[model samples]
Target: MPEMLMEVEEEDDVVPNGRVLITGATGLLGRAVYKEFKDNNWHVLGTSYSRLRPRLEILNLLDSSAVNGLVQDFKPHVIVHCAAERRPDIVENQPDSAAMLNVGASENLAKVAAAVGAFLIYISSDYVFDGTNPPYKTDSVPNPLNLYGKTKLEGERVVLQNNDGAAVLRVPVLYGDVEKIEESAVTIMFDKVQHSNKSANMDHWQQRFPTYVKDVASVCLQMAEKKLQDPSLKGIFHWSGNEQMTKYEIACAMADAFNLPCSHLRPITDEPVGATPRPWNPQLDCSRLEALGIGQRTPFRAGIRESLWPFLVEKKWQQTIFH
Candidate 1:
């Protein structure tokens, strides 16, 4: 816990904004956003589904009264909507939960945020598009392929309709700052490659463009900052890492980064079998984000090097001490 707290807090930081309300406060990106807002001295209130810690206050987003009352009392200037049933498999199995949490809760938040005259920012996904296209723009029509994507798209619509100043940020698969490497799929591939003795069959069919959590959080904050002046900076915007690689290629890159043996990693050129459909080419064009001068610039290799740091060092230390 001390280490987790320490992982945050860079020497340089931004000045505080007004109050902020963040849902899914304990999630991967949620936690990062919370820490970022707090570090910058913003009055930050975060909500979680489960009782996680002192910082995260558990609240049932389905309970419209609870959500409305929370916003009314907190009176946040900005609301970062991060809570949702994001996993495709979980959403597929529990469609009810997905609809309630993703779509319904989003509508509730947007209504409250609008009533309170607060700027809303909804975190959306790349899966909103079917894999038939190579790159999607902000104005691209969403043709969701799974229940999760459907709910997110619906959530986006409700949010934008409710609050004209609300921003919908569509991001690709995000990875970074994990307690365990397996917490992120990208890092999980790296972990598997590092620990496993035998070669692995790496998927090479679908194209993936993974963004770092910090980058996404940064963009969210920048948009929020812009809202302070230009309240009209609202609409669908996309942010992604500049890198485009297949899973196999990413695994190979990870192998090279960690000095692991790549001979064991065999490229399997086939689509992955799953209960949910995956977008083959989820390459999003960030021209909109770039036009606004808020584009993400973290190169994939540099981002990985930053992410792998203390964790990799700590792992090697544990290995030495235990062995």
Candidate 2:
């Protein structure tokens, strides 16, 4: 808790007047956004559908009427849309439901924002790419490979179509702690180490640009403030950490950060082995965001250290400790 407080203080120094409305506030990124805003004295209002309790308001984004009602009632100056069907396998299994939530709900929010003249900051993904390119720029055409990516892409388009003054931020793989890291790419590898006492056959070939969850939240708030100040800064932008590395490299970094045995991690080639297709390359070029003076603050090792500390403290391999 003390460490979390210190981190909050550091974030507060960057942004003042943090009043915000965050969707998916129960998730890792959402929680981080909430804290970032709250620490900065921003009157934050959050929404959540799952049983997971949020610090502020909780509403189901899938419910259209509910979303509309909340937006109208809250009259938030900024809306950070973080809620979505993020799982690739589940999204593939139920594309329609994913569309309903990811696309439909987002459009509803956009409409509400327009009615109230609120600034919108929609969180997007790097999965929108097909993985053929090493590092995708903001101008690159999106070629999604899966239902999740397609749905998120549609959501982005919906927001843009609905609002002329909206900011859609495409971020890469985001990692942080609020609950256990059961499904995250980084946590899955940690699970392998915990049970097998050996690293899973590492797919060293697959490259991904991982963004720290807190940094992502910080950028979101900063972008929201920028949009509020200058309405013309409207369009799609790429936001990610400074460095890019393969899954094996990330695993090694996490292991080294936590003082764990890295020998257990073994390198493997890029080969598909499951029903879901993974992009071999999904690194994003964040120069667009950097030009806006919103660069990643935490280095890979430090971010890994911050994320791994809770698991080490709990003596349990959990992805998040707060939620």
Candidate 3:
């Protein structure tokens, strides 16, 4: 587990370059964001409801009082809000919980962060846009197709409206350094493909840009640094990987990475039936961040390979009958 610094000692005289408070610090993207700020010599504190540890502070963003108390005590210069219900399918089934986390908690956090004069960065998703468009920009209109996207879009609005200095960063599908394969939509493909004896149907229709979590974390750090230097950095931004791939393509890549046979994997050429309604090819136009030199796109092949290699070794699935 990566080290997430706890509350600073009251007597510590040395002032750090900046202080950052990261919500959902135990999650995939949150973990990366926490590490990025800490590595750059910032006084960083992370919060999580579950996955609690010795150094992390237990925070439930939904509780207005708890949220307010923590932000006031930490007095961070920036608040990176990464906690939310990101799974679309899960959101569809659990609308109430999704709204509470994605909407209510975000709104509360925005209000609290504003009271402390902290710069807020709310992590959003590309699902805000409908699938009919390609290469969506920051100004693109949002028409979320499912409950998850809808709630996230609502979260963006509340955060920006509540906090004048809030910035909404919309990213595409993400995968990196997960504690479990099922933790990420991208990494889970390996699990599906490993069942080589059974036939698996993978979606090859809706195009997706599988962004890396580490890269997103780097961008968050850069944005926070720049925002401190220039307060005008608040607004909407887009950061995504350039490589375009479908689920079938991603599964095939994972199989190739581990030299596993994927003959039983079949590609579904049409929209996935009866599942969550996801946008097709809602590719984000990342020129805004690129122009400012504020992003990075790791090649899909290399990135996914690195992410899944450890799991392969751990599971002892590296050896095959033929090899």
Candidate 4:
């Protein structure tokens, strides 16, 4: 099957002169970031640990020497660290691996960033919160409940401690059409509905702040460029869509937008019925990103509509669902 072409908004800004290094370029979010910078005509260098077919520099982030070598070679002015073990359940099961990738690799990247004097933008998660608050602010103290969140939070600390000029943007659920479906809840749900006639039975009780992948990447690139030009604009910022939505709401919205049946939905609680601890609420207040001139352009429904088109045409929806 031919790869689905992505529809991105054209921006007139020329890619800056300095090189930009993006880790995890194979992943959905990372790939979006790569496209954003590449479109601007910036000299883009990317890294991938497993999927090397996409033309990214093959490098394991855990390899400190290799990371150092890449830094020396590329000499990027901006380093967007998007690589991490992001599976919450898997991270809880295997913390050591998660720690190695999320915490240790991040520290290594920070060291390289400091050595090369590069502006580092680390992608963080709203899961850093313990779900006690409704809308988390950038200044909110993080109390992670799961290993994945803990690891990412540690990564955030590593970037901040290592480089005072670094910017850490904490985002929530990211929804978009991408090659991989493993890490995207929105894609997973949409696939289930489109192929298996199964719908996500999300608890209307649990709510979250979701951002479009393209929007998130755009914000990250803008922030990185701004930070490169002005050293004083360095700190942690919260980046999320403007609204708070439950999983059920999102699923229904997808179904409605795509003309899919929504009857398969089953209501489940925010808490795990048998095992695992689920963060009931992971909503973030993105006023900080807004103030920095980075915010959501399309509404949730419109974004979902745009994302669903590729799935409908590619007929790959069935491939995305399990059972």
Candidate 5:
């Protein structure tokens, strides 16, 4: 299968330009993307349905009229769609709510984005592929195992169908400067282990690429800048870290990072607790992303060092800058 990537001209950091509207501002990736664009000199407007913060507007995505109205008011040159019903359990139990928010909302946003003639960037997932695939490429056929993946795939279709110029970015498990521990998956284990001090079991068989949200944001800004200049750069693009490790390995790394009890960390090889059938290996081939001039990937250890929550507990923010 042929991979799809739109390599646009690179820009200088001393100057950042354009206007970006980010949905789901309260979410991990959304928060990072908002900061990324801002740091790059783009005027960014972020939205959250529940939480209201400085520079963040409240907009109900389920309400098309409200979304469209906001789009008209803001008139952003780029619309980054990060809002979605992401939890697998939630999507499984509440299919209608999932479809309405994940699928329907994206459809509406695509229409509004097109109306404003803005470049639409939809954040997708690696869940679209089954566990059988080790290294999923942009051209890989989607074989979603869960409702969340199905809904996201549907959202991607709606986005691309509505606006051909829209860019679909598929990422893996993410970690960021989290307001809450739940914001980052790896941190979830860290939280559990730190508090428990007893033991933690992680899936050793299942492999994942825990991409850094800041890195995701950085590459996204690059895509947005290129999209703003080149309209032809439209299609499904895969972006993730080169680092590949299982959940067990991730937990161990976090344990060391937080100075938690590493000995308590155990691998679940026989049966993953409450484990749902998922793509065991969804390692993304980022050569396409690299060809676009984005080559360096944040190492797992280094990414954890730059992320937020850990710093609050230990003040390690001075360790590094955004990659």
Candidate 6:
């Protein structure tokens, strides 16, 4: 924990439009969410467990007392739950640990937020739906193919059950300004594209809408603001990038957009063999959130370029080509 967080400022001492608590504040999506809320002049206090930072409150969500104490002390008006065991393969390998965070921790956070009379927004995934269907709606039945999706779906259920005014924002694969290329599932492919001499096989069987984290974070801010004005803005909602592409297509776009090499990349047209099963094309129907006038979708090419440019420049890997 940082010494700044130990100072313990009284909730009433600060006056802002609203106060928001973001979990997993050091992760990809959480960082964006923290920035979005803070830029909007909201009183934002982000939490981190493993990746501790100066501003973030080091919190272990699995600890019930710590969770309650933080929420009670902060007294935030909104809580954005972004922390979870998100990796599908890893979740499959450790279902029990995943459940403790994705399911157990989520339920606890939702309950705590409700007890504090705060509006909670639970970040969910499109993987909750099986790929047999196209564009699943907010109310669509979830048939997760693997343990990760199932755990997220269960988290959604517990959150909604615990708080009537809580919302579940289901999004698809995400990419953003990453601390490392491997931080994002989408940008993780850059390794293959960057290694000009190394041949790699990319998955082209499944369709994915790679959404931007900054856009999702903006939507979360909008939802929080709207919820404050209208308390009835609750329930499951979907927000995803409209541009559809596969991993192979994404790598191709990265090469084109960033002037990276792709000759060594091979596209696998069939479902790629993996330890975990993923949906073929579980595109989310974002109309529910769009209807409420809350959403943003960045084009894939432009978004990826913006996300990776800084990292590329920092590594001095094709600095001349970028400018």
lDDT (CA) per prediction:
0.84, 0.80, 0.89, 0.81, 0.81, 0.92
lDDT of 6 by residue, 54-127 (tens): 98899999999999999999999999999999999899989999999999999999999999999999999999
Q: Provide TM-scores for the models.
A: 0.89, 0.88, 0.92, 0.88, 0.88, 0.92
**Tens digits of lDDT, candidate 2, 128-149:** 9998975888889899988888
TM-score of 3: 0.92
Clashing pairs for model 1 are 199-264
Better of 4 and 6 by TM-score: 6
RMSD value for candidate 5:
8.3
Q: Which stretches of candidate 1 lie over 4 Å from their true place?
A: 1-15, 310-323
RMSD of every candidate to native, in Å, equals 6.8, 7.4, 5.5, 7.9, 8.3, 5.7
Number of clashing pairs per prediction, in order: 1, 8, 0, 2, 2, 0
Candidate 4: what lDDT?
A: 0.81
Could you tell me which residue pairs clash in candidate 3? none
RMSD of 4: 7.9
Give the distance in Å from residue 246's predicted Cα in candidate 2 to where it truly belongs.
Answer: 2.0
Best by lDDT: 6
**Candidate 6 deviation (Cα RMSD):** 5.7
Model 5 poorest ten-residue lDDT run: 1-10
Tell me the deviation in Å of residue 135 in model 4.
1.5
2 against 3, candidate with superior lDDT: 3
Show where candidate 3 strays beyond 4 Å. Answer: 1-14, 313-323
> Could you give candidate 4's per-residue lDDT for residues 1-323 as a string of tens digits?
13322222223244365699999998878988999898877899989988885568999998999999999888999999999888787898998989999999998898899898998989999889989876788888899987788999999998899887888888888887666554587666776555535445666766766678899888877887777677887888888877677777777777788777778876675565654565788778778778877665568888878776776743465556654
Q: Give the winner by lDDT: 3 or 5.
A: 3
Where model 4 places Cα greater than 4 Å from the true spot, the runs are 1-16, 195-200, 313-323
* Candidate 1 residue lDDT tens string, 218-278: 8888888888988779899998887888888887877677666788888888787854788
Worst 10 residues of 1 by lDDT: 7-16
Question: Candidate 6 regions off by >4 Å?
Answer: 1-14, 313-323
Model 1 global lDDT (CA atoms, 0 to 1): 0.84
